[model samples]
Target: MKNASRRQVLQGAIASAIIIGFNPAMRSWVTSASAASEFESLPPLDGILYTDSATRNAAADDFGHLVRRYPSAVLKPGSVEDIVRIVRFARSHKLKVAARGQAHSTYGQPLIEAGIVIDMSSLDTIHTMNAEGAEVDAGVLWSQLLLASLERQLTPPVLTDYIELSVGGTLAVGGIGGRSHRYGVQVDNVLSLQVVTGAGNLETCSRSQNRDLFEAVLAGLGQCGIIVRATVRLIPSAQNSRVFLLFYNDLAALTHDQRWLIAQKRFDYVEGQVVPDASGGWRYMLEAASFYTPPDEPDNSSLLAGLSYTQGTQQIEDKSYFDFANRLAPTVAFLKESGVWFYPHPWLDLFVPATAVDRFVGEIVSDLTLADTGQGPVLLYPVPTDRLRLPLFRVPDEAVVFLFAILRTAPPDASAIAKMLADNRTFFERNRDTGGYRYPIDAVPFSQADWRQHFYPVWGRLVSAKRRYDPDNLLTPSQGIF
Candidate 1:
């Protein structure tokens, strides 16, 4: 399916080894200032710098599990001007800059060892919030934004599973959760973006504005520039929401029904997750809910043709809008408080090609059941790829697909982390051979050579965009884009 591997990567080694074009003098200066530390001598910004390991480690980021990215300085920019100044200094000296939002990245991809980290988490100002739209700073968390919107009886059109994540953070990588089936992705709802490019230029991006930067920044994973502000499209808050769970013993049945619902466009939000079975298999937990009607009325009434909405399960809770958005908060908080959150996440997520979904799952179910994965669940859902049905995401073609992932947390111990690292390597190997993969602002151990092959037909476009916005390659070096 995919071309190349860890061993086979050397085939492109010779072409990669030759830097076909370069200005030698400029390149020399770039090398000298690449790790610039003169920020200590520079004027103060609007926020604070956090160098302490424990403080930086405590951040609720996806890649906290990556042990290697302990950065030298963490700057919590308090204002857009602060980000501007920081970018200016970094660009002048060719220093690496990473915009840290929720740090929900599973790999230490967001963390840059011995580099400067602009903690967008400090610019918590909410610029605007109304039925028409809302504008927020980079550091504003989704939770706070929702609460603010509700005060005005307005809510953003689309949001992620974990609202505590910063708007800029999720927008950079195409945020999607249960609601994505209908609204597209968190990025799709974005109306505008205030960005500071790698070269220290501040610009506003939108369809009518700098549209190229806007598209690249959407699900671009902080590669092009730092998103210091975003204008999110909003709709009237749903009055009430009814959440229901459908349990499935069979994976095939689960996927078939899930695909059908996505194609049929029957629900507002739809997703399926898996938990371990006592028999060591997995139980698929699916739910489809909406606020259009009262809570008692069943949400499952032939959303799909064959599957029974319920083998007849009873009604669950009809939650408030805020409650439904944070249904998983308590459990996530419990895990965080218990130190389970610190463990590395050796996660593998992929978009299985429509034609091979059945064969793909069949081959791996046993290994997943037996694998000693840490805490977290295996997430599996079949999503519609028809262009008109789901407009927010960027799929290569109109092909039905499965969004599959193994989510887990690694322990603090070096040995345990190592085990997880190894497991991830093995898992990536298994998937790459299938030519079925894609990553969005996640930890990517896969090499640059391999990554190109992963993108395949779109690889050229991705590379062109990367070179255009990040010519000097100063933004998010931790992602290893160069």
Candidate 2:
């Protein structure tokens, strides 16, 4: 029922447009418009389809605040049927299609110049929930989904640090955070998906059914199919959580303690960050969390009695699970209000081998100052390799992989953007030489050759999947892999 050809889906859209009073005179103006007018070739459905300048400009960029790619038209689908119609129409006409969810990408991965941009956010719907899992629309934000699930006394096992991103958006790129070390990436926790392929077929896939699609679509970067809906695994929710913060002046000591802590399974969650040390030196802060009932609060002293931390600098806090998960709300609010949130973010994310992390951090941190990174945090953390099972989400061969990120935000001036990109390039080249794998979500100007190198062993499988599911390369034209 979700699959329909272009001609078969026009009635709903036509009816809606008529009800809203479609402007007949605008047809003449649309025809004379830029190449964006090519959208007129497609049949409509129950959605808002337009090529006006306002909508076009709004869909042109993403969170990076760089790379403007104006799509021919933006389609806000009211139902899955509309997506099927729009994609089928684009495939038939050899036009490109990009499925956009929240536009949180640092690069222009979701933008398609002179092509159709499908706004998936309008399809937001959280259908059902249970102890096992919940079936929800891809456009639903992780924060929104978490709130709804908490109401039912359940929650997703793994959540990114920033939950404002869309489910499909993070799933496509392998969502990672502190919990990932224990539960695995968001993509690994999926149960099933309702994907609309480039060929315009609405296929339901899971681990046991349509197995190839199920594997390919996770972290598939919208190259294989557009994930319209997903069944996410959930866990019993806890009422409260105990949080810990430990500081260290030495990188080796911090990373060593992290490895020991994760191996012993001493905490429910573990991660670390690098901040400017008081005496103009870089310091490491280890963050851990434990869930428990209010009646059975954990002994913070017992938990940290053996760990080595900076003398007399340990901190502990207690918060409800909801408040703990949403602790970053204040930071994000400050960024938004400071006007820096709109600045161009030439971000870089990479996974370095645990063995090489010491040297990697040493080289970068030696020259890195707060000013050099646009005052953004230089986040560094370790993750277990066993949790990441998908071949497409590449990582180092070591037992532990360290995630190092340089999240830089700069003014819109050409010189500022150029300087940030230059710094990013230098950092990336050094990391690549050290056998590190780029996360690909950052603003790296990747070449086809670079992408192949990034996915060497699994490159063939990815290509095969792309051909099988999106033979015409009609999806995610901005990723530049095809």
Candidate 3:
């Protein structure tokens, strides 16, 4: 009698939802509630399953503020078991599922329409830390891990420019930063992962154990599994960092110097930027940092000895290691306060072959205007291709590749957003022709063919792994990889 009463209530809710004009996809979920066998009740979960408009609406968009796809429900899992149960339920119901971290992606990569959205933030916990590495929940932010690691005088080998991103989020995509030139991207630094496959199985994978799943899950963009926890590589941390800012008027000169610096490994960190000059032209700035303890400091003369940057235009600063790593916090706060953080960001991130970087970047900069770039920074830096080992983390076929990112902000105007998106498509095509690959974080559009081409020789491996781990094709459908 109780089960029948519950079914009646659910049927009433479905009727109301249909009359309210739910979209087709959403209506399917609502109608499914009327099914006697399947819609009796959701499986027991450790966390809350939210169907309220407020929670569902909040999960509808991401950092891009461009696309919006409302999910039927949001799951704030209290435990890893909650995820397992929900995924199993979703698979049984043939519903799509996606795991969201900070929602920092500039596209709809994490959004799922009329499906289940797993909110990973509720599982924020640092499991353990040792001389070897740190094990943390996927919801734990990079900044949180950094502070905790500092207590033991250890740090992750590589960190993204923005430390506030979630661990599972960044590892899903290859986390790259100035330090990546030496230590490789963040995914390359991971020692192991605890993942829930599409089939709802919890498995621990590493290089020696479950090697295929390990490679596919790292930088796999959540196609095959949801990363629940990770054990990442760490190293001894320095007390302070000495940073050098070298200016260059010539594009070729800047790239040349950046390549030489990474090749010689003179600095612990190397990155470059394209900034607008006072005269409405663009100039290059090479930013490098060297780590040191109090007793010993970096010798500026020795570090900058052979650099071809313009003379007398150099600036230097000293900061604690923590401060240096978290430098973007202030800027992020300012953006939020000024209302710029909510603007639409049609960012374009590409990995261009080192051989074509100078010519490719020079042409783009010459044609760009302040309006097109907005208030965001333009980043260009070289990363050694040989150092990146993960199979799914795609890069240009070369000894070195340049990470060129144009983080553009568009006003809420429809025409402006449309224009920027169109420009992105054009830029992507040109970069693709030049042996470059998209970083998959931007707003650029892609089709199945493009994704296949992006994977190229390893496409078969990716397919096989997906078939093995996510047989039902129920994980991360928003990525459109399959």
Clash count for each candidate, listed in order shown: 11, 0, 0
TM-scores across all candidates? Answer: 0.83, 0.92, 0.93
lDDT of 2 at 196: 94
* Winning model by lDDT: 3
Question: Better model by TM-score, 2 or 3?
Answer: 3
The predictions' CA RMSDs to the true structure, in order, are 10.4, 4.6, 5.0
Among all windows of ten consecutive residues in candidate 3, which has the lowest summed lDDT? 15-24
Q: Candidate 1: what lDDT? A: 0.67
How would you encode candidate 3's per-residue C-alpha lDDT over 400-460 as one tens digit per residue? 9999999999989989888888888898999999999999989998999999999998999
Q: Tell me model 3's lDDT, rounded to 2 decimals.
A: 0.89
C-alpha lDDT score of every prediction, in listed order: 0.67, 0.83, 0.89
CA lDDT, candidate 3, residue 209: 96
Q: State the lDDT of candidate 1 residue by residue for 1-482, as single tens digits.
A: 02123332333223122111112334321212243422223445444444445544554244555646655455666567777887776666566778888778877667775567887766777887778888998788989988999888788767777788888888876776776666767787888999988777888999889887887777776788889889898888776777767877777777777777777767677877776777767666677767653444544454434664447643556778888887779988898798776667767667676667667765666566434467477777765554212122344343666677777665667786676667666665665566556554444466777655655665666667668777778788766646
C-alpha positional error of residue 85 in candidate 2 after TM-score superposition, expressed in Å = 0.7
Model 1 poorest ten-residue lDDT run: 15-24
